[model samples]
Structures are given as structure tokens and as C-alpha cells.
Target chain A: MTDAIELPIAANSDVVLVRQRVRTSAQQVGLSLVDQTKVVTAASELARNTLVYAGGGRVRIEVVGNGARGGLRLTFADEGPGIPDLELALTDGWTTGGGLGLGLSGSRRLVDEFDLDSEPGKGTRVTVVKWAR
Target chain B: MERVPILKLGDVLIVSIQIDLQDQGVLALQEDLADAVVESGARGVIIDISAVEIVDSFIGRMLATIASISRVLDAETIVVGMRPAVAITLVELGLSLGGVRTALNLEKGVALLEDRDNARAVAVPR
Candidate 1:
């Protein structure tokens, strides 16, 4: 099963719309509320990052089923300032904007697999996956 | 979109979050918190995020903004009982809440609010 949804909106005011869409789609694939919530959360966080920092980004969501278990994957790509330091950005308690340094680190924990790629002055891309295990 | 009540802690008010405070939920709350804090002028505000599982950058910014806005209004802000997973996500994403205060429980948050009111009452002697 190969299905994906792509959403591109202004980073300024599109967080809720994106999260709700992801949640609805995840459920349509027969994902439980728990799994759907996790996916919704990840999508929301990534969307927020895209809007707030990157001035907006794109969300790519795909669901794949394998035998007894299925999984959800989300990729958030932003062409903003990009992260200057990946390590520092990933570090808990370390934040440049000084909010609850828990977005990415926290999102990583919610899902099963997480990957991040960013180059300064280029862009940032975050991919997260959660398996129905 | 429920209207929150005047959450009372002793003599002070503990204004629970009106917005969902999750990823996108933060947007609605973000635009409202500062003004709400000022208008309500509650001695303390407790952002109950137990129902929320995630907080993104925009949400983080809103939380920060609430706390900052409260300072001028002679009020304090406390983020209460965020899920452990959410906390970790924020830390990893580089959304550090250096200025905002957090509590393990809503009771603790209320107590803090009460204490702040007492402190102010003592200073102003009203």
C-alpha cells in the first residue's frame, strides 16, 4: 500500500488545519486513536516549526502496512534559516528561542523512528515514523 | 473551543488554557493568552496541558508570550503537568522554556499562585 498526502500552507497560521488533516487521514487507514494522536502530534509539531521558524514548510505523510502491523511516516521540509547546530538543536534543555526545549526531542520519543537533516542557510527536513506495534 | 471559567485558587484565579495548547491548538491560544492574561488580570495563570500531547515551536512561542505578557500585568504564568513525552520532544526540538515556570501538578501550580498573591498582598498591604 503506497499512499501519501502533501500539504503546503503559510507557516504563519496553518498548524491546526494540518494536524487535523493528518489525524483524519491516519484514522481512515484504520489507525487506532493512540497511534492517530501520535501522528497528529508529530504533524502538528512539524507544521508549527515550519510556520514559526521556516516561514512555512511542506508536510508529506505516508502510511504503509506490512502483515500484522502498519506504520505512519511524516516528513516536514522547510527552507528557512536552517539549524546552525544540529547537536545543540537536538540537545534537551538547549534552545535558542528559549521555550520548552521539547519539540524535536519530544517528537522523537512519541514515534518509533526519527531522522533530521538540516544545513545552515539551506533548509531543514525532519522525518518521523511510528509503527503500530 | 470552550470558554474557560475563572479558575480560583484561594483568593487568586487559576485560568486554565482556553485553547487546546497542542501543536496547532497553540495558535488559537497564542493569539489569546497575552490579552487574556492582561484582561483577566488573574494573579496566576495555569496552562493545563495534560489534555495536550504535543507543543510545537508556534505553541512554545505562545507559552513564552503568555509568561512575558503576564509580567507587565502583575501576574505569573505556570505550565502544568505536560506529558513526559511532550516535555522530551520540546527539549530535543530546541524549544527551551527558560523564562516560563513549570510545575509537576496543578495543585502545585495553584499553590504557587496563592503564594504569589500572598506576597503581593503583603507588599501592597491591601
Candidate 2:
């Protein structure tokens, strides 16, 4: 990774900052307009999840490379009450927050790689990557 | 909390979102639009999001909610000027904006509203 930045996700405004920072990193990594939009949108969803579900958290935006290919990676971590069921949480239309429940599932579809980890009493961490095409 | 401004044009209320709207701003806009639709007695509401770069689940939901709210107030809602990339990202994000109508740009959106009004006028004979 050449450049990595961390931003807080404590409030609604912070989520907007996360999205802007991710979009900049995605563009710097040579992502196309559509690819930039995809990664940024995914980042927005995860950042909001950190705030709404976990109370507050932080996100690390990184520019990664694999030989000649470059990608943008985002890691959102929060210490709030962790999810009990990973499968159920990732399922579409299943939400406890009265939302559409598409944040996790839809974000997964927008990126090339997605990994989520959470411990009931511990915390939750979600990492996603989108490569430039 | 920065609020998105709503402009009035003829019998339509136009809201051009040019900022990276926070969640609070989105909610405020929804309320503002509902009020504007009623206060102005607008027959149509046009939301221009051409300047908006991304539309996450929250923003997508805001659009749908605004559409529903305007419908309840007896005004048609049409979202216009959505960037191609934004459209693609929204679909991939699993938000089709189901109840919200869309147009290529503001001009087309206005024309659509006008056509609907004309059709309604003929049908009602008033």
C-alpha cells in the first residue's frame, strides 16, 4: 500500500467524509469513473453501518497494488455490540435497524472482494476491495 | 446541517442537490420538499441530482421516501440528472428507487410533468 488514511465514523457527517476520502483514494489509484462510484458507494454503506450499528467506529482507506493492477481497500472497525449471526446479517432484507437491510449485502456486490468478522461481545470489522478495470 | 435548497418553477418545485449530503441533510430535504410541495401547491416535484457523485442506501432511501411523501401530498415526483455512474452504482447497491420516476435531465423531467398535467386536464375536462 502506498497511501493509507484513517477517518472517524462517529456521526452522520463523518460518513460523508469517509465517502469523500475513499473516492479520492480510488481516483488516485487510477479507477475509472464507474469503478470510483462503486467503491465510494460501498464505502458509504459500510461507514454508515459502523455509526448506526456500532455507535461509532473508524475506517482505513488504502491504495493497494498487485503487480500492475491497483485497487482501493477499505476497512471499517467498530467496538459496539457485535453481530450474533454473520449469515443472517449478510442476508438481504434482514435488518433490525428498520433499514432496507441492503447495506452489507449490496456493498458486497459492488466490490471485488469482501470479508466481514464479528464477535458477539467483541466488535465488528469489515474489509472490502475494488480493483480498477 | 446544510440544507439542500428547493427552487420553484411554474407549478413544479425543483431541488438540485449539489453537495455531498449527510444523513441529516437528506432527512431535512425530505421534510422541506414535502412542505414546499404543499405550500407552493406544486403539481410536480423535480429532484436534480446531477451534481451528486454517489447514492448509498441511505441516499437511495431518501429519494424513495421523498417520492412517497410527495405522492401523499398529491404531487408527482421525478428524479432527474442522475449521472450514468451513479445510476449503475445505485442498481448494483440493490436500490432500484422503485417508486421514484426518473428522467435524463431537467428539461425532460419538466416536459414529462407538463405532459402528465395536460393528459389529466383532458381526462378531467376541467
lDDT (0 to 1) per candidate: 0.72, 0.92
lDDT of 1: 0.72
Instruction: Judge the docking of candidate 2 as incorrect, acceptable, medium or high.
Output: high
Give the lowest summed-lDDT range of ten residues in model 1 chain A.
Answer: A93-102
**For candidate 2, lDDT tens digit of each residue in A1-133?**
5688889899888988888888888889999999999999999899989999999999998899988799988999999899999999999888989899999999999999999999997999999999987
List, in the given order, the native-contact fraction of each candidate: 0.27, 0.93
Q: lDDT for model 2, please.
A: 0.92
Stretch of 10 with least lDDT, candidate 2 chain A: A1-10
Candidate 1 residue B107 Cα shift, in angstroms, is 9.9
Cα lDDT, model 1, residue A5: 84
What DockQ does each listed candidate score? 0.24, 0.91
B1-126 per-residue lDDT for model 2 (tens digits): 898888998889999999999898899999999989999999899999999999889989999999999999999999999999999998888899999999999999999999998899999984
In CAPRI terms, model 1 is classed as acceptable
Candidate 2 reference-contact recovery: 0.93
